[model samples]
Target: MSAAARAHNPMPVLAGAVLVVMAAQQAIVPVLAPLARDLELPEWSLGLLMTSAAVMFTLTSSPWGRAVDRVGHRTVLLSGLSLGLVGMTGFAIVCQLAVSGVISGELGMALMIGTRSLLFGVAMGAVPTAAMAWVAANTSTTQERVKGLAQIGAVQGLAQALGPASGFVLAFAGFLGPVWAAPAVIAFALVAVAVLLPKGPSRRARAAAAAEAEQAEAAAPSKPLRPWDPRLWPVMLGGFGSFLTLGLVVVCVGFVVQDRLGYEGADAVRMTGLVSTVVGLVMVTMQAFVVPRLGWPPWRMLRSGIPLVALGAAGLMVADTLVLVTACMAVLAVGMGTVGPGYVSAPTLLVGPAEQGRVAGLVQTVTGSTFMIGPLGGSALYGINDWLPFAVGTGICVAGAIFVWTRKGPGETATAPAPQPELAPDPS
Candidate 1:
């Protein structure tokens, strides 16, 4: 196919890839408790495993993204898939050996923790950076790219719903449940990459193509300048706050749901799925219809989302009734759904094509760090009072919103021209 044709198709593939990876990653979170018990590790230590992965993910994102920019998405994505496979295999082996009446106590726990962390790091760090860059490069219009991004989140929600639900079943089946399942997901992803992701054009080749396109478009008038950039600090800060809240909630949602709402173990798990599914659906609805028609400014989304998330914290604090808490969860979902697309789209809109991978990695790393902090912070506060952490979490979200409102940044308004759409067609 021609260069133009290649660019036209890559965006959809990018979105699909992201969804698949997210689904696989989230599938594990719900089952962590069981996995811990089965592996004979303490529940607290299992929590640490989750935190360790986030730290690695945050720290590595920028560097991996930069490398993607230098090399290509194909290389970076494949490397991530490989890491996932290794991690999953490690997990399976550890579980199998442990269940077979081998590797008792701390030794078994250590093995599970270490391998799981490594897998989490690779999965979290690589997927977002590569996928974001891939979409940015392939899509020709900002709206289309945003649509693609929204789809990724939607898929992530779907995955979140499925991962734990399915994982619960798999865990009981045996130690190899998540482990064997992980490889299957990775294999499927590999196929998607092969069929969907276009080979990116190299720098030397792209320069030649741009010169030709410039000559062709010279007679056409320039497009209007987009005012606010999406990459501004406010958007990133807002996203960090949002994810931080999510990480914390994901960690403690079971306890909160059970104690506050009169839910038992399995019931709490189901509720978690319901909340995630609801959020996913809401996000799909908003990004698909509302964002386009209402066309509220990105800042408005940020402002609104923060307060809604705060409401979730409040819901946790009071916990008077199941209905009340459920409403709060929905409110939080709306807030995140409102603001998330803007944040996801910001850096791509701001940076040049060459920097997409690096910037994406950096952003993921930053976001991942929030994931680490949220759980740790929540845990520390949870010790004081069950409600304390949720209360404090709400306060943090409110503060983040305030910062967004007062701050001047990209996505605040449509002042400057938004960055141009980047196009690269592979010769191969």
Candidate 2:
């Protein structure tokens, strides 16, 4: 179907589905300790669970993009939910039944990692890519697309807030019980998608849109998009750096609070949880209220966000008390909140509509890559000094800002990016 003739679609259903995927994924963080105990594995070995899932998420996103392009978005999304259900069920069963006497610790860890990865590969498949693509496809104008992207960002932030908080709250009720919450959530999400989703651009709609486009052939057409447009790299680099910093922070924060500050395990977890709560709330407010009021280009937000992240990380280097750490985290959250909305919108605006899935996937892949590397790097650096990871992570953010600043085009802050010409609708 042609892009111009396409009508704006209500995509709240798809956003809700993506939120389910994220919730399932994020729930594991708070439950990991109980999982390790149930499986009778060492902390180091259990770490493989995340490593495996991240590896899968990073490797599979592109193929998932291709699959969505080939299959319908709804089909692929259902497939992902099914995979998540199976993976979570497997985790539940394995934890309930696996005999440490027979399975051996290393082997058990390996099994958990494999199952976790399989689950992640499926649930995460089309979510990030398809959800955004659906938005870009259905939305009729650049302004609407920004609104769509902002909502997406807000939903993701809400997920970050609720997912772990819910898990932890359930954990507070009792150990191991919270871990069971994921399956139920996934199941409910599947049902919601089934009921709420529109049958996705109908065949008749596609054909009619296509016919109208041919009739308007004499009209002046928009310029073809340059996928490798020079402005793209700075934006992309900033995104990569931001995720890298985030990745490192997630993995290292607990260790810093415990080892460096001489806190107990519970204290460390609470501190991290508090930081997450603040970050999530701030993110929601920024996207919902602040971004709209300014009407500023995304690049401007990115510029402000990157340096704030640096300041937050730098503050972490000196923070010795919970209050100090919390304030620093708040600073970091503000920086991240500023940059995040813009980063989410960057590839969508840059690549045009036709390639939204592939390009958005590529952009999300940076996030996946950060997940793959950040934990490992942070853990190793934490061994050297608990403060070193945040310090170095801050430096990386600074470098990314410098790179973005040096680039051309009035700070490269695009107000309204061009949209792609629509492609022939897939029959699959």
Candidate 3:
């Protein structure tokens, strides 16, 4: 069907898929210590497991994005979810075996990392890449695109807020409970995608679509842009800086709760969870309610958000009480809420529809890279001095503001690309 004729919005299904996948991925986080004990591995080894997953997630995103562009979003989404199901199930079985004394320690750790960390990481990269690409391809107007992306971000934030709590609650059943639950969640997502997501064009139709798109692009004065084109650097850097700041705060805040606020053990954990939940709520509120109402352009959102983030980081630096810290972190979450959708949507405005998958992949790659670097970097800086990570994050946010402020907003052609047909799945 033509772009003008495409009326159904797939954002809800895509967002639902993202929520389930992210929840499953995050559900294991709160149980890592228990998992370590159950598997008879050191606590730090579990940390390595998480690090390995981040590494794989970073490496696989771009390729998966490119695949979405080729094979279609529905195909890629289902494929990724299938992989996740397999990975989660495998990891759970490994955990069960280790706990039951059916597998040795070293072998079990290796198997767990292979299935849970590496394989699951690859699936993690694929799901979001396809989902974002689906959003970009399905939405015809900038307003629609921004709203769709914001919804995705909001759902993801909600999932992050609820995932750990679910994990902690499920632990009462057994350590393997959360582990097995991840696959079941992914299974449901797989069914939802298969049933609800619109089908893409057939091979011949896609070929024709590509040809027509290419002809239109050639006729237009402006050319198609690559993901790494200079015009997109501002958006890319803005995304990286925003998430890097977030990573720093996530890793360092617990230490601050313990050392600075005199909270420790379960008290420290509870305080940290409370702060994170508050942050997630703030982010969800902004993205879901505040951003759509404002409807500002992506560049404008970035300009407004970056300074707030810097100020929030500065607030964290001086905060001496839990109340003060929570207030500061709320400020930080507000900034992130503003920045997140803008970062995702801005690049889509710059590129044509054909490039959306690649750009979305690049955005996810930046996020994954920050996750890998931020915690380790923040921990190192914290080791040097308690205040160091927040200070450095402040600098990063300030630099991000300046970087975005200098870049030109979307040009006329970029603001309104030719209406290409939606990349829906085959209806048959």
Best by the lDDT measure: 3
* Model 3 RMSD in angstroms: 4.8
lDDT of 2 by residue, 302-325 (tens): 887899898888898888887887
Q: For residues 1-428, write the lDDT of model 1, one tens digit per residue.
A: 23555545665665566666666666566555444445555445655777887777777776776666566777788777777767766866776687677777567667766776776576657776776655555566656565555556566665655665565566555534655686677778877877666676677765665564455446344442221224455667788888888667656665565556665444444555455555556655666667668666667777777888888777878775756766776777777777776666665656554454445555555566787888767655665677877787787898987887787656654543354445554322
Please give the CA lDDT of all the candidate structures: 0.64, 0.66, 0.75
Ranking by TM-score: 2, 1, 3
Q: Model 3 compared with the native: what TM-score?
A: 0.75
- lDDT, candidate 1, at 397: 90
Candidate 2 vs candidate 3: the TM-score winner is 2
The candidate that achieves the highest TM-score relative to the unseen native structure: 2
Ranking by lDDT: 3, 2, 1
lDDT, model 1, position 187: 72
Each prediction's total of clashing residue pairs, residues at least 3 apart in sequence or on different chains, is 18, 0, 7
Tens digit per residue, CA lDDT, model 3, 281-302 = 7888888889879978888888
lDDT of 1: 0.64
Cα distance off (Å), candidate 1, residue 85: 1.8
